[model samples]
Target: MAKLNINVRSFSYKKGIPTDPTGNGGGFVFDCRGILNPGRKEEFKTQTGRDEAVIKYLETETKIALFLEGVFQVIDISIEDYIQRGFENLEINFGCTGGQHRSVYSADTTAKYIENKFPEVQVTVQHVVQEEKNWINEAY
Candidate 1:
């Protein structure tokens, strides 16, 4: 049998709950509201987390690093067990007020981390609020 590791979905709370694209429910949800919000600033008001400026602000000026560490620790345990059990579906949603800034960043960060750490897993990331609607799927 082919090994299927993980599937992740990132979305805004405004868009409603993110369901597994493959039809599974009961995934993890992380709220990014606790982190320092960059959206309050005038310059960052129009920007999303994918932008360089927003990235810098979240990484350097906020507690996002530590926040993500805790997120990873919790998710890692679940992911490891999922892989062992031959589970093929997992959904992770990051939610913020606007789903444009903090939530988007958290989703992207988490997806990238899983992709890098567990090459056996397939990772999918979606930014629901962006005009272009970014989607990334990485499989190995």
Candidate 2:
């Protein structure tokens, strides 16, 4: 089996509904937005580069790396063991209010992290609610 790194969370909330990782089996899903601050849901009106929200997401991931407690613990166990035993696939999910900004950034960040950490693993970023290219083109 090909080594699979699944990113389940949608790119934006509109399309990025997270499924039960347990149901999918033993793979780990690191929910940067869900576990760290589930209650602080807010809609970002304007996307700012290097904004507080983005910083928060990055901070959350870093924190998870340090302790490996809570939800992150599960991922740590799965990936570490899988790497040892020569496992084929792994899955990760990052969720946020809209999935567009925070979740997308988180997923991308995590994917890059893992790939660099483990060169053998294949990483894929699946955006749930992909923005329309036309809209972006029009805006630009």
Candidate 3:
């Protein structure tokens, strides 16, 4: 059993995501920013976003096979190197425009993917921009 962590801010940028495994390295951190739709009219602050058709296409059964293949390429290289190390953590970041809809959705999707693939590992989602602890505390 091992531990892998993925951090996704949104499907907009890859500021926090990590590059693919280069062997003898840590786990993976998928950049979900590619999945975000910039919106019809580019605004400084707003949630006009959507997933690109290309991304949806890649997630399909056929493409997912290839996608997973690439993901596993890193995983395999990492696992072989780190299995003896005991544990590994992958932090994936999904960033979108407003960090509400697309980012949240991508994070959930990535977490789900990790859970399905590595059932023994722990998967967690952290909605940094959208999750407002301040608001919750104020309301309480």
Candidate 4:
């Protein structure tokens, strides 16, 4: 069986999309900008999507669950096919205003979802804005 490498990412639309490190040019890009932003709220301004408060705001106050349902359905189809086809690389990107809240939330959740659904798949997550800050792996 071919090992499927799924590179999940969060990026800022303003800063542009994250490039595929695997050099496979085509993959999924889901825009998170359409959802209500928590950043506009003073409480969530400094918090990343990984933060409990930001996660709560996004999960309870916005349409993030619905949006992710659609995204997961789409990606699920492709992942099943990719595994069978022995394809090796897949990239999924979520973009929003700052790449701090919405995009990050989606990417992290999607990575976890993919991990649970496709046990053999190798999932890596990157927060581009956070990476630029040199704090990629930390729970910020």
Candidate 5:
């Protein structure tokens, strides 16, 4: 089974390719800046995407759902090919102006979706600026 490393980063903190321990230059980077930003609202200014309010706002008021649908379509293909090819590592990154909100939510959602869909694959999600990481299948 292949393992997927989904990284979420802040554009303000880092640019260019993410550090790949696999050393194979394998990954995809998606920019979330084009999506509606929840940070622009005063009520959500202090909130991260992990918060229920922010998640609800993003899900209801923005195009994030559609955007992620497209993201999953592309990533699903890549994941399948990687598993078939016996490749062990695949990385996908989501970046926004700050790693706190949109990027974090997207990364977490993507990781969970991958874990549910492909239980045979290992999945790890990391939020760069937040310093948070989750190993989805580790407890299973």
Candidate 6:
């Protein structure tokens, strides 16, 4: 079985965090609302975090890089520990006010990080709010 590194999700605080469909329980839930929101600006209102403009805004204008650095450190421990213990499945969630910008960026970035850093484990991302709208997920 493929051991899950994280169940990263971008969620709205109003809607609450998403449950793990991975069937295994317990993981990190990072709140991205504390980061500066680009959604407040009219230019970025319609853009999701995946967009280059919003990505640049988050990386340059906000503390998201620092926040994610700390996140990677903490998650690295769990990944290492899980491997040591012979475990499968871990959970991780990222939440913001709308789940469109900060949370989505964080979740996607973290998944990519794990895929590159670990290379053996599986990484999954769920954009809770965006998926409800226009995003269609593909095999990762």
lDDT by candidate, in order shown: 0.79, 0.51, 0.46, 0.91, 0.74, 0.85
Put the candidates in lDDT order, highest first.
Answer: 4, 6, 1, 5, 2, 3
State which candidate, 1 or 6, has the greater lDDT: 6
Q: In model 2, what is the error at residue 114, expressed in angstroms?
A: 0.4
Candidate 1 similarity to native, TM-score: 0.86
Deviating ranges (above 4 Å) for candidate 5 = 1-17, 132-140
**What are the clashing pairs of model 4?**
none
Superposed on all Cα atoms, model 1 deviates from the true structure by an RMSD in Å of 5.8
Cα lDDT tens digits for candidate 1, 5-78: 46555556777776666777777988898988887887887778888999999999999999999999999998
Instruction: Please give, for residues 1-140, the per-residue lDDT of candidate 6 as tens digits.
Output: 54645567888898987887767767889999889998888888888889899999999999999999999999999998887777788888999988888999999999999889988787778888889977543211
| Winner by TM-score | 4
Scored by lDDT, the top model is 4
In model 6, which runs have C-alpha deviations exceeding 4 angstroms?
A: 136-140
How are the candidates ranked when ordered by TM-score, highest leading? 4, 6, 1, 5, 2, 3
* Candidate 2 stretches greater than 4 Å from native: 1-26, 34-74, 131-140
For residue 39, model 3's alpha carbon misses the true position, in angstroms, by 4.8
| TM-score for each candidate, following the candidate numbering | 0.86, 0.56, 0.48, 0.94, 0.84, 0.91
Error of 6 at 68 (Å): 0.3
Stretch of 10 with least lDDT, candidate 1: 131-140
Clashing pairs in 1: none
CA lDDT of 65 in candidate 6? 97
How would you encode candidate 3's per-residue C-alpha lDDT over 54-125 as one tens digit per residue?
Answer: 234335522334443465566545544444466555555555544544455556655666567666665566
Cα lDDT, model 1, residue 60: 96
At residue 98, candidate 5 shows an lDDT of 63
TM-score of candidate 4 relative to the true fold: 0.94
